[model samples]
Target: MNAPSGASGYDAVVLGGGVAGCVLAARLSEDADRSVCMVEAGPDYGAEPRHWPHKVLNARALPRDDVWERHTAVHRIRARVLGGSSCINGCWNTWGSATDHEEWVRAGGPRWSASAMERHRLRAVEQMGLRAVPERELSLWARAALEAAEELGYGHVAMAAPGRPGFGTPLINAVDGVRWNAAFAYLDAARQRPNLTILSQTTVNRLDVRTGRVRGVELDVDGRRETVVADTYLVACGTFGSPALLLRSGIGPADHLREFGIRTEVDLTGVGANLSDQPGIFVPLAPTPDLNAALAAKEASGNLYVSRMLIRAASDLCPDSSWDLHILPSAGAPLFGSLPPGQYEAGISAFLMKPASRGHVRLRSADHSEPLDIDPAFSTDPDGHDIAVLRSGLEIVERMAVSAALKPLAGAAQGHPSRDLSDEEIRSRLGAYWHPVGTCAMGQDDDPWAVVDEEARVRGVSNLRVVDASILPTVPAANTQLPVLTVAEMLADALRTDGR
Candidate 1:
């Protein structure tokens, strides 16, 4: 657990070697003059493909084992490896719409605007080697689903491209058949740099803040306590972990800190507030004879089962903006343990991309090891806007299930056979897409609820910045991986330019 020989102090100590952490560590270390240390709470397999477990390397579906269980509502799944969630996510690379970043500008100013963020987005995409799945590789079930969506007047289902929104095969960050995670993409090339030190299996206890500046971090390395000092610190521990770190360090609301016997240091009320995520519902359909046969043939040939098609559409509620609903169609029921062994089902998961409902993440105790209380407060928007949009999406799914192109392939839906469920019923079955953000929201000065400023620096804490999904003012209309990477890249550029 001792420092990696000569690693007593560093120019920058990045906590949590996840998607954003890997990007920042790699980019910052490129200077060759700055000493960087990345501490990850999980195993680090280096850059070799052979070192990774089968689940981490598999690109077929998301691994469900590594997750933070949110009380009964949903399990917040995030990978605990060098690459972070990028190692086990759906591999969907989406940038959302221009309006998504425009809202960031409104909240955090022009620096985060779409035009300003384009270069970072491009850098991330190129580094990750993102590419659209070829049409020829589409599974039988996927083809039928796209055809049915178009027949139902959802327009031509094509592949998703940057700055464009429509129905298409989602671009993914996968190479061949392996998940091309951030560690493999970013950290691999920089692993040999002497200035960069990656400490695996190291959990951050809290930021060692004194007199308003973070001096170092107390860590739990294999149950042994240790301290690592740095001139500056970046918390990239993700949405759930980042804010929890701040709260445990007595940097949250003063009243909340008092209740846990921790003296307040910063008293930032917004540390764990304004939590938001996409709530989605699954519509399962039994596969038709033809679909089943195709699947069997493909299985026998050992062909890769790729299901990357998605539909982005605007509901009646938010017609003026970019699409607010994501219809993700899959060849098989990918949700872990959702179906029986031999059962083959094709389905679509509809997510309310831009939700109005908000929630919060609070500490159950001052203990850093204890899980935080995560309440997404799904479908609880006072105006009932979230539910209304979901209802419209449900109707669309029903129509697609019965369309001529898919009617023969899609049998009766598993849970709701009638599709005539009331709005209350829909709300009862709401679940999250697991894209949590905004816990440590970035906003302009004078905003009491803003935990961080446009530069991603913690409002009242000096030499400490949070660069992760937690800083996103609002969840984008697409999957969070690409957006989070872009933010990290931009922040790294800013830090480098500042010569910190």
Candidate 2:
């Protein structure tokens, strides 16, 4: 490994080159006075073989040596690149609503209200060049299904604020039919700054903390061990990586850290607790005789936005809820398996956004080389509210399937063949989207599990912070990418406001 000639230590070191890390690296280096170093355990975005826009094509194809093709779980998708999941995720963006941030505040995120979140969202969209465009009517299957949902009391939600609902939501990360991931939005700009340096394909094993202060880091690069010293450090390695790294570094619960023969830095019990993810349901649509020709004509053109249903989870069986509906214009290739050809396959996916169940992440071995246990403990929500919401979602599917506009596209229902099945059967096939949140939670000192404070500073530790989705006490009602970026944006503003 070759190090830069003058490279030594940086003013700030950002672990993980994912969306949040990229934003922080860019924003912190804006002043040019502070030197920022962003380290990614993945490959550079340009060299990665598979890209976000071509995910469908890759889905049909098998995996190769592409850095974007790393699977975090047995049957899940993860991208290990400079842009992290943004380099390989579906190009759909869900800018969370004001209520989402309000929920965050209630959950213990400090100094972050719904209004503050809105300002950050606006700034993010403006930077991404998300312009509203007219919806093209070529995809009849999607159009028909959306129309059916409307008739059944589910209206289209404009991804924009100000309460004007419409059919299309602007694609923030997609510019002129190309994928514009976080690498392009933040990391690319940061690369030009002399003070900002990015190191890729390096995995951080642990931290070097002395007297409750972060001093440096220990890393493994190409089968070699190296050390890096930094004045301040921030961990933005998403939900899993951050907590696992902290745990491996003996910065978690004192008892847990002791079992691994590592001395404890802090007894942060909530370092890897309160994990949550949304469940998903896909309803397919049939095609008309002219569907092929019509789709071909409008190829490279699409609504590219989600027309979602802000429905609740289930009956009030649980304090929290599960399963919110997302009426996307089109579905990506089947997440679970293959779909039969010649079917007009438009879909409405219902995600269990407000799930009552919770899970946690832990290290199976003290070894940093081993994969962490994801222990989602999914489908075990005590109230069974997730099942109930999905059942309601299934009823919605049935209603839309039989609608005047949708029946033509949905030639026949498969499961029950002649009739819709009972709620029990629908619950059987429901699954989850891979949006994980809340492992290293944020809260006040009064909170038993609070790992960091409102300003993202690690409690009991100086010059060490966590600036990622891991700090979210609870998952929001929308996709995590947008919210995570918004968190970084707000933090950046706070840092600037403090002149630190």
Stretches > 4 Å off in candidate 2: 1-7, 46-76, 97-99, 107-110, 160-170, 284-323, 327-346, 417-428
Query: Lowest summed-lDDT stretch of 10 residues in model 2?
Result: 56-65
Ten consecutive residues with minimal summed lDDT in candidate 1?
A: 156-165
TM-score of each: 0.95, 0.85
Candidate 2 lDDT tens digits, 1-500: 22333326878888998889888888999988888888888876452335433642231222324343354443235556777766655444565444455566865553677665678877776665554533552255556655665776644555544232223343445544455677777766567778887888888888877789977788777777777777778898888889988888778888877777878888788988888777666666555556544554454354322232233223333233222444343532344455455322455555666666778888777888787777665656777776776655556555656788767644543555312545456555555566788888888779888888888888888888898888888766566777788789988877767655
lDDT, candidate 2, residue 19?
Answer: 83
C-alpha lDDT values of all predictions? 0.82, 0.66
lDDT score of residue 148 within candidate 2: 64
TM-score of 1: 0.95
Candidate 1 clashes between residue pairs 3 or more apart in a chain or in different chains: 158-168
